[model samples]
Target: MSDNEWPRQLPAPDHGEWHDPPQARGRVLLAAGLVITVLLVAGGVAWQLMSNGSSQPVTQPSAAPVASATQPSVTPCPDPELTVAVAPEMEPVISQAAATLKPAGQRCSAIQVRAEEPGVTVDAEDQPDVWVPSSSAWLRIAADRKHVYQTSGATLGWSPIVLASPAALTAQYAKDGKTAWAGLIQAVTEDRVPVITMPDPLITTTGLLSVHGVHAATALTTKDPGIAQLRALTLRSRLTEAAADPSALIAQMSRQTDAVTASFQVGVFPVVEQQVTIYQKGGYRIPLIASVPVDGQIEADYPFAVRKGVKAGLAEQLRDAISKSAVTAAGFRTQPTAGGARLPDSAAEMLAPVKQWAQFQSLAFQVLLLIDNSGSMNEKIGAGTATKASLLRESGASAAELFNEQTTIGMWYFGAGSVSDPAHTEVVSIGPIAADVGGKSRREALAEKIGAYGPQASAGTPLYQSVLDGIAVMRPKVQAGRPAVVVVLTDGTDGGTRFAMSHQDFLKRLGAAQDPARPVPVIAVGYGPDANMNALQDMAKATGGQAIAARNPADLASAMAKAFLAARSAT
Candidate 1:
């Protein structure tokens, strides 16, 4: 029979219903038929007994010699443990679920999950036995639909991203009748509210959701000015660093003197529950209240999936647990409960959140442009009136525009002091440009600061000293994982510094400050007749950057733009 064929059930013969043959010659045939009927009856009875054994409370059957000889022993499988991998944002719910599962004698293990920024791609290629993404975007990016699909992953779980404020401030706003979501968004976007904190939208689901919620309420989807205003507010924010967990953000809020507003998950109940105690213990006198936005709502759904290539039994157990009641009580909706194969709830929730909070996707850059302010810079290099000052200004302007509001531009003027006089050597800090639009443009500001830099053709250049000063000033502000860049433009050799730190020293310091596994690139540009091309190349090579020789001011602009593109691409 083919494998698809169903097994046939045999019928038993009735007791005392045997028929005899008419003739003595047919007696042998009748006897043979009687024996065969008896055997079939016994076999049918045995099959029924075996089939009904587990459900019926009964004694074991007595072993018949022939049946016992034919029967084989069956070995049972050992109980399997259920494992789950969850995103870091949903740890509270996952932990609670794990606790409940443990007491029921159902073995459970949880893996911490973190989604890659901008896209919810898994940072690591290896799949967990069960993967739970904080956002649906993560599920789409991380999982292969054809191989292992989302059987069921969606639920109405609250991951509230509140606009946190001091209780006093919230009360004041409430009294003024201006505490709605619309009011808050307007106030924040218009700069009426000075101090506000938000997570990097690229990194945090809550941040992204909050932005989307606001956008939807305002109907400002196509408005460029509105978009730019929101972008500016997000960019000017001093805090974008993600805490290890939600609790850490709460701790930061509890310690603040100013009324700080930020987004956080509602499931982190401990943050709300312990607010008074934290405040009292910390001797904080201010009242902090958490309020949900009136016009918009956020419901984040986290899904647990078995990673590809996981062992079969463990994967099945995990799927079963995810589909079971225990997980639902902890706030996860199982596949069967979600009604479809796709994680729809999670997907819907992700859309609005990401759109509003897309500004966090902007790259973080550190650019140090070292300009050559020697006497030769006064001479024009191109048809567009490109002097050294003009070249430096042009390069700085291009960098500022290319980087736009994303990069921090710092300017340094070298060879300003007497080249021969070591004591007169000076390295002026012109502009450390941040996202502030009101601050002087990095290039124009630097030109104004070093307008008097010329005519003194000094005997030496304090090249190494200027590099050290630039590094020293910029190091403290450097954030980990951000691209740190130093762009040097010089037209002379190393000459004036009393203390000579070799190129190796510079490399060692720069490398030590950065993660050795992912070092920063430092580009160098040369201009003028006396420009030390070899030294610039050495500096760039040492830092994994490039050295470009731009003979004219226009060339300098192209070079800077190229460098800016490279920096953005790195992100």
Candidate 2:
């Protein structure tokens, strides 16, 4: 339900002061200082990753990234050593416990503590023996993408994802009542709250929470018109240091604009509950108020999960050491221990589509679809097999059958031609898939065009020239945050004599024209057994994309979809 659907907003929870009790304050200051120091260092490193590596492709870990991992990246010390990957805020508590875990007669059992971002641990080649993320969403997303140990880690403590905005901004939109995602989105749509920011989804679990909550409270499903409104709002952001903590964004927002003025509505940030606590304790350059949705709740339930093959008794020993409930800190809220529970795979799969929706809101996907009209595409399989072109026609035609009205599509079919005169033809110009007035839907038109598509006028395969043509068309569509890609469906390599540029010139052109900041991943897909995988792979890697091979023509649809999502969102 929306904000207006409910009469009143729930009272904001009253939080405690940000300091330790008088009795313990004096004794633990040094330890608290070290932990806080580690947090600061971690923040700096994250900022660097954002500024420097934002353009790099997302590389999967080489190891069995998912199944049968031994332990996280650390070896056992001669003495008993347990390496624990803890969220930055929980480092001190876990580290303290590590100091005391000695085998009955042993001198010490070292807990090598590493302060990692929410989703980083899952990527460790040697999976961290224990995975503790701020929110279960991280663990869940990691599992959906790969086969992780798939266990629900223990919840050590809780941190809700809150909206940190100036009192004036909340009053403008949410005053006289409570604000929920519905209200927040309404305000944004009409331009009441113009400046809103979120951290990078890859680096902060809070980012995922904000994404999920916004998705849940508003659309609940990507199919809702509400998603379009969210997409419009996402396109208006101006904050930087997207991979860093709330501190970096808060500091930056302060300098950009403070409380509401004639020109500014206070910036609304989706931040961790602890960051709000830190600000309320009074070190922030700006003052802020925290708000959680009345109907929708989002929290980081720091889960301590164990990997497979952990010695029979080690998982329990680690779980006990991390989430004893007796162990609490000022910034964190102590919660009851949640034993070994796992998010069901079926549920994770159901929720996974919303993530792609969220990514699309901030990341625009501009893709050019290239279909081969070569004679080979017309070849039928053994006796009963349909031609590759026939399969493409069937899949492309089914788009109109789905409830989803996707972004505009540009469809082209290529064959033989030179640099001066390209061998390709545009079946559908690059434009919105739906027309403003009466016209057969682009989806329907596309399906018809491809279904009837036959071999090119000649039997030549102008694969090289067509690739260059595709790059030219997709390059201009690249934008920051929104990724662009060129997807090609082909049955064979270049056999035509229309190749204009030397293989070197084509390489040099793509290399020099490529923009790391707004990379256009050209995903080359080889359909059927005769297609050249090596040629396709080289083109894909050169443009920061991938080449996928499928032995059967019928599987091209699924393969193309996979390549589309990965190429556009991988970086």
Candidate 3:
């Protein structure tokens, strides 16, 4: 029944904390910090394969008989039939539990089950009195929904997210006896594997956790929360057969062949252990083995959310039965023991990475690389023989590779001899990388210019005017969806008799030109100790962008990642 159909006085279901029993609480705590060491039994033997690199396929465990259920004849029923919405994957488990809850006279049905994805039900207009979503992550994401429901402490089922691959690939990845999450991310980033299919995280739990892993690994390795690696991975993966959802990927895996495996065309997938269990039950032409990342494991802990006005005793009884059926009937774990890697415990923690993943996949970029070719750029970098000018070419080329054809790019350089009208000489006009320019692709033109960049010993920095000029060039051409950005790289402060745009006047004019409707952010990077970071930071603030001070020239590549990401939020 809808909220209005039920009486208002029914004690509002627990809308606050997820109340867990002692054992469940322990499992949650175990899940919080450590890797999953929980033993999952299949065919009467415990699958202690998480820690050890076991290539054995997971066998299907024996399950309780699921009774075929029919519509309840509510003619003589005294209490209203309860409606329970469950995740499509968990529908059978819930249906099995509901089958045994017939009225005493067998003349009425006590409950009805609706199979739906949690993502759909969270915002559905008509909510069932009870909800069993696949993961608590959904609950956290929709925390502000108008219909408040109390989450049960008792998780209906547990399934650790696993990296699924053909036996040969699994063996290769876990050659050292175990593979880590960081290692899996590295493999994806480095393209060690033939194909690693990832679903869109905004829709699939598997995709969400996979992104979490990717971001965690990126942060662990780089010590910065940057999507540079993610940008490259997505661009490369687009070349493969992209799966619309996890089911499509799983279906593709079932057709894998030994020859295909040997040829290395088979792709790897991130999936839940329960799926691995279910897939093994049907058997595949080429079997897939589960590799739980040694460093950590993130699982879908399906929680039962009881909406207010749900029949009091009825919800509890059904929860118990469903919890019991989760293990055997649905191929899920009833008990979670401590041992796998830890994951973000709250929704707030997961949103940052998830948001980054969304933006990387959805947004295209239009950026101008405004580089400084002043004399200071000719100085040696950190006592190294390589001058800053040479390093700029390397760093610029590296960062440019992260952008795809859809991204638009351009370049300009400013210095003393930059007597051009704008105090910066344009090498490439802003355009999509795929667009043709002077018989060569824009990408090719940008690369050729970026590589040939060098410092002019007589040149002095004309940074202030260049900032205004870059914005002027970009403002009128700002595309509807693509984020427009100005990336300023300078080794020295504004100097020399250039256009007389004072710092205060430049900020005021820049601020006035900013249309809330069309934002063009400036990501300003200052290199070396002599660079004027304070002025660059002020410019960034005025333009709704970010500023980075790179003490070492090598750090500019990392700064570029942060630059693109900061510009991603531009209006």
**Candidate 1: segments with Cα more than 4 A from true spot:** 1-80, 88-128, 140-237, 240-244, 251-301, 304-368, 371-486, 489-522, 525-539, 542-571
Cα lDDT of all candidates, in order? 0.46, 0.59, 0.66
Best by TM-score: 3
- Tens-digit lDDT track for model 3 on 319-417? 777547445555788877466445677667766666665565435678888999777888886676988888777666656556654577898888766
User: Candidate 1's residue-wise lDDT over 1-571, tens digit each?
Assistant: 1121111111121223234334732454334334433433342224223322535468999977665766887665343344455554344444444454444543433323232332333544444456665555566544433335353444423344445554423432232533445565434333233334455445555555555545444433224332323333332232323222334445444444332222111111112112223333344423345554555444345555555556556444333444345444433334322211122345445443353334333456766766655455666665656466655553343234333224566665565454244322333342344322346444345434544444344434557666655655555655765656676767666655564466677557655555445455566667665677787777666666777776544455555544544444433
Residue 395 alpha-carbon offset, candidate 1, angstroms: 9.6
Clashing residue pairs in candidate 2 (N, C-alpha, C atoms within 3 angstroms): 72-127, 72-128, 72-129, 152-341, 364-482
Q: Using lDDT as the measure, name the better of candidate 1 and candidate 3.
A: 3
Candidate 2, 145-201: lDDT as tens digits: 563654544467787777777654555446555657666654543344545566666
For model 3 the local lDDT of residue 402 reads: 61
The number of clashing residue pairs in each candidate reads 10, 5, 10
Better of 1 and 2 by lDDT: 2
TM-score for all predictions? 0.38, 0.46, 0.62
lDDT of 1 at 24: 38
Please state the error at residue 341 of candidate 1 in Å.
25
